[model samples]
Target: MKLSLKKFIKHFGVLVIGILCMSAGVALSKLSLLGTSPISSIPNVISNITAIPIGQLTIAFIFILVLLEAVVLRRQFSWQNLLQLIPGSLFGWFIDAFVRFFHSLPNQTYIEQLGLVLMGTVLLSLGVFLEVNSHAIIMPGEGLPNAIALMHQLKFAKVKVYNDFILIGISLVLALSFTHSLAGVREGTLIAAFLTGRLVNFFTEHANRFVDWMTPATDANN
Candidate 1:
């Protein structure tokens, strides 16, 4: 019941690293000119259409999800849950910074673009795995499903599928409406959706040994 400062710090550090990786992956995917991760699809499209920074839009989108969660969960939602805004803001900032950093990268050929997408997928999956394992903070993209599951007393996996469908659908509609074509949601988005979860599970199964190694003996024992 008591929290351990050391453990909390460790998980916090891991969470930051995961955010960095996820942001990098998102940036690379965008640069590839193929597609973006499903969770980022709407923000990326809106950014392109509205000229607003993707990071700023991402932060806004995440806050909206948090508000929705609060509305749905009502009494079950505690003020402490609002603390997620800090990490969400950090994530959005990182996404913006990485997008700027990768903006000049070249991906001319079809092969090169595909390679970028694949690499981005790996990074995104690894990041999600680490973030989930850390359990330090919840990304709103992930937290929305959690809130829905809690509210409906349904399975998390089922809620997650429903949430992803809703996001993809919204992104598709926005892309078509604003750009008059599919922009952010495309084949690569499908690839990421299909592979990221499997990769996360694979990494999660294999990551515990490394995590244990990094943990202090005292912490491990406890």
Candidate 2:
């Protein structure tokens, strides 16, 4: 039991940090004024349109995704999946807070902006690495797609690729319709998408030892 308790604490702590990194990554990407991840593409467009805070819009978007998950899973939707809401909420709030905090910092040059894109990508990849290792919960951004893939008996990778293209395309249409230009979908979106999976895999291979020590808990009730 002591071993289990210690493992839980360590893994939980890592999970919390991982989620924070993901939030920070999103905020940094937004601050760059270049683009954001596909998961955030729609909410970012809506935020630009409604002049609503992106974080608030993200929360709403996450709720919608969670609902989608429920719809896709139906009876298969367990409490474990429902638990995505908590982190989803925090993910939004953290994005807002991070954006507000970093809003003042300027990336005047294209190089500097690119630097942020790279940093955000690294943070995001690292976050996913740690989060998956912790085995605590899924963020709604990925959860919706995962649920869909599960239901359709499709590969998660292929589903995720299709999902991302759809998101970026939708955001492009929305931005063109209202904003008359790309608001949240840009080359950086492509950059982040292209790099994130590679980095996640890279981290998985190189950083395995850092997170391989503890395993997620299992119990009779769980």
Candidate 3:
């Protein structure tokens, strides 16, 4: 029981950090007007069109998308998957709102902007690690990549790249229709893929030992 509690704490902590980091990255990407990854890009596009709060829009859209994914994939519904959305959306909203309060900060010099971008990238990568290590059910956008990997017997990283490309394509169409622009899509592709991919590799390699130790707990639950 003590071992189980310790494992739970570790997993839960990672999960919380991971979800928030992901949302923070998305929020920063949106602020840069550079767009986020494919899954996150949808909410940004909707926010641009409807002028609704991006956080609220994102949360709602993700919930709907998760539902669609479950239906399409015939996945069993899980509370953890649904719960994961809460932190992501709430953190995203907090990021957007927090940045709005400091509008002038993002409008810095090229170097400064680059720093913000890098910081955002780091935060996002941390989030990814946290969430992936959590033994709970995955959120929808993430699940899509996992499903694809499972179906094709490909690496999760490669599957993610494919998913990002899909987002880039969708964002392009949306940008053309809404504002005749694709700044976010372009930037998200170039930056997010590079940073997120590198981070994923780094963490996955370095954390394997730790992950192996936790595997038994996860297996027991299964």
lDDT of 1 at 48: 76
C-alpha RMSD between model 2 and the true structure: 3.1
**Candidates by TM-score, descending order:** 1, 2, 3
lDDT of 2 at 2: 46
Q: Enumerate clash totals for all models, in the order shown.
A: 0, 0, 3
Summing lDDT over every window of 10 consecutive residues in candidate 3, give the lowest-scoring window: 213-222
lDDT (Cα atoms) of all candidates against the true structure? 0.83, 0.84, 0.68
Backbone steric clashes in candidate 3, count? 3
1-222 per-residue lDDT for model 2 (tens digits): 343665567767787898899889988888887888888888888888898988898889888889989999999988888788888888889999999998887788998888888888889888888887877777887888888899999988898899889889999999999999997888778988899989989988887667556344343222
Output the number of the TM-score-best candidate. 1
Cα lDDT of candidate 3 equals 0.68
lDDT score for residue 126 of model 1: 86
Candidate 1, superposed: residue stretches over 4 Å from native: 211-222
Which pairs of residues collide in candidate 3?
18-127, 34-184, 35-184
